[model samples]
Target: MASFDKKPTFAGLKLRLMNSWMFVAFFIGFFLFWEYSVLWFDIPLYILTPPSLIIENGAADLPRLLDYTLVTGTEVIIGYVLAVVLALPLGLAIAFSTILKRTIYPFIVCIEMVPKIAFAPLFISWLGFGLLPKVIIVFLVCFFPIVLNAILAFNSLSEELTLFSRSTGAGIWRTFFKVRLPAALPQCFVGFKYAAINATVGAAIAEFIGSDEGLGFYIQIVTGNMRPDLAFAGIFFLTLLGLCLFGLVTLAERLLIPWHISVRRN
Candidate 1:
């Protein structure tokens, strides 16, 4: 019998490197260039701290940074979860019901039109410097996209799909779970990815306006104290947090809708 196993070839190695190692190589090269460029230009530490110093300072303050990260992460997770949980049902109702379409939809549109960041200060004042305000801000920022996408997803289902489900004697709930929900999920995930990005920003903006802890507050304090290196470190942490949240949403999309053409293309 012929053996089925094959050794890895140069082409396979090249493909793997191109797919995975390219990003790592680019990140390393970019930071290395940044570090040397700042040194070569004799850039003032206060104005533009090099990556080496940023890493050193951030590592030194890792414990406090982790605390701030936790605060912001909690706000983002809670608010994002709340938005997703509530928006789906509301979107479905709005898509199906004329009354909600006429009444609630217009109000939602008005809310979406207003700048979300402007509400941060008011939320702070109303809720005091608690976590609730930051969570609310995150919720507001995430809610609209999810709702709009859900409505679009539900409405975009073809009449033929519905008729086929009915022809099979599928009940409303069965059709929703088996046909409607699966068809809708790919589009819905687009909103989820968008909301995940916004959740971090909303929390940061809220913290910037008023809060005692969080990466945003930490950056503001360090910047005011003329510690640009520390500020950069805080910013780096904030970005990492956002990336982690976004990664979670992307992972969920992959898990829930692995058969989608968008997921398969990736």
Candidate 2:
């Protein structure tokens, strides 16, 4: 019998490298273009600083930026955790119970209808300029997506699957653990990913409304001082923070649902 194994070709190696590093290459190319475009256009620094200057300024002020990042990150973490802890159970309850669906669900919908940002000032007034208000904002932003997704995930079980589980003589808990939970996890992760994206926004907006520190406040202060480079630096860190949060949620999804079609495809 002939050996089936073949040596890797140069083209295959190059393709794999491109697939793995495409985003990094694009990021570097984009910033290089931005840097040169600003220099070529003679754009005023106050209007739009080049990426080079933004990096220089950010490096110089790394400690301060890190401090503000920590503050914002703290709020995001606390709020996200709280939202997940409460929302999942509540979602499950609402999915299973008609009473909750009729009563509490509508109330939640009404609350979610209001723009979460609008509540920042009220929370600040009530909770003061402390961390609690910012945490509350993050919680609100994360809560609805998770709860709504959880409800949808739990309800999405097919009638056939339900009958099959019943026929197997599985108890409620067994059915939930073996079938419902796994099936629902993929959709639940959709909410988690969305909530992760919003968590950063919620914290930053809350800080923007009323806070002495955080990347949002830093950006505002730098902008008022006509330091566009520093403002852009703040934005860069904020973007990094958001990416980190999103990455964590994605990692969790992959770990928990490795057998899922989405995870398998990835």
Candidate 3:
């Protein structure tokens, strides 16, 4: 009879530990250790629940948590879309017009300099405890990075390229579409990646400030009820959402800019 199993080789084990699988293994190991330590230390559930308990609570609360997650996710998506729509044209204006670049950009920079959290209460008061306020807060949090990066991308092109396009009889729109836009796409994605992560935090902050819905509100309620495990479960979902969004943006960037040195190397 043929043998069904082979001994694990050192090389095979080393390769496995060096790749993405190792990340998954490390997280599993951490949670296992956390569970064992909590039990061994006789920690109170309210103070620090074990991973197992947190999982249990998550399973029990999954439906409600998912509902909240959906609400928060909607706000993040809407805000990010709005920021993109508004920031791009403004960024182009900043890049193409000397007056706008020198004048309006300073005011924009000054506005961005203010702490984003400071505006949460103002947004809530202005828009009330509704989706509008949450979306606006998320927009404010993510808008700056998109605009700044877009301007940088647009302006990074050499004057030689612009003259070359003009020499070829390419119209302004054609030059912009064919040359500058393609050149700017990679950096635009960098902004998108940053915005994706920030949008989640922004939504959470908005929810925390004034809302009965979303993961942030759920966490607040659970924490107030002294259910740290459930609160942490909500946090876990938010983290997953942010990571997923960031990953999606990264994937899109790689797909769109495969010719770019950064993408090719990766």
Candidate 4:
């Protein structure tokens, strides 16, 4: 919670914004010091190229980088969409059905235990060398979070509320839609937060293994060529893409769960 000497005013907002800028200033200073160190210590340019070169190369790559960023972003979204679409029903099934809870849940965990990298080549073989494999990888990485969160959310609902609604003659569908689902949204979004971030990394990993496009592919080839500046460009774009998707998830949370109380400012 935020404390104040008195009631809120425009000055308070200004002060808050000013306080936020302090961190930005600190970051600027730290980077400046690091950049100077690269120049002063005669460091291998590749290991510690100043942000100047990073910015220049990154800007040079911006047009193409933006296009590639879109590809990765789309892969992340499609995979996450697929995960959400599949997770809810599957999770509810596992939660509500004894057989699924007993038999399916363990198998799901077993699949997650295997390193995704080990399976990337197999995914490429089966899906072929295209966007499909990366999409599948993203889906695989993101799917578990949603499933776990859904299972928890569904199970966490009040039994009394379910009983009361049933006693009041609500059907299962009605009860689930009105009570259980709305209650589960906060949990779903908590899952979404992790899923969103991991999906991007998953696509990057997939692209590193296969595919001819994407920032990951760029980084893979660039790093091998020992051009760290260009590699940094790829990384910069990766960070940009991740931030955009994370922002989307946060925005969706606001719209979908405004009553969540978690985001409400005091």
TM-score leader: 1
Candidate 4 residue-wise lDDT, 97-160, digit = tens: 9999999998987876887667788998888868888988998888988898888888888878
Judge candidate 2 against the unseen true structure and give its global Cα lDDT, from 0 to 1: 0.91
In model 1, where do residues sit more than 4 Å from their true spots? 1-14, 19-26
Looking at candidate 3, the ten consecutive residues that score lowest on lDDT are 1-10
Worst 10 residues of 2 by lDDT: 1-10
Off by over 4 Å in 3: 1-25
Model 3 per-residue lDDT tens digits across residues 1-266: 12322468999788877786878988999989998999899888888999889999889999999999899988988898899899988988999999998898998889989978789999899889989999998898889989999999999988899789879998889988899999899888888878898999999988988999999999999999989999999999999889877888888886677678787664
| Residue-by-residue lDDT tens digits, candidate 2, 1-266 | 12322458999889888887978899899989999989899998999998878889889999999999999999999999999999999999999999999999899889889899899999999998889999999999999999999999999999999999999999999999999999899999999999999999999999988999999899989999999999999988899999998999988886788777787774
Clashes per candidate (backbone, < 3 Å): 0, 0, 0, 0
Q: By the lDDT metric, which is better: model 2 or model 3?
A: 2
Backbone clashes counted, model 2: 0
The estimated TM-scores of all candidates read 0.92, 0.91, 0.90, 0.90
Winner on TM-score between 2 and 3 is 2
lDDT of 1 by residue, 24-129 (tens): 8999999999999999999888888889999999999999999999999999999999999999899999988999999999999898999888999999999999
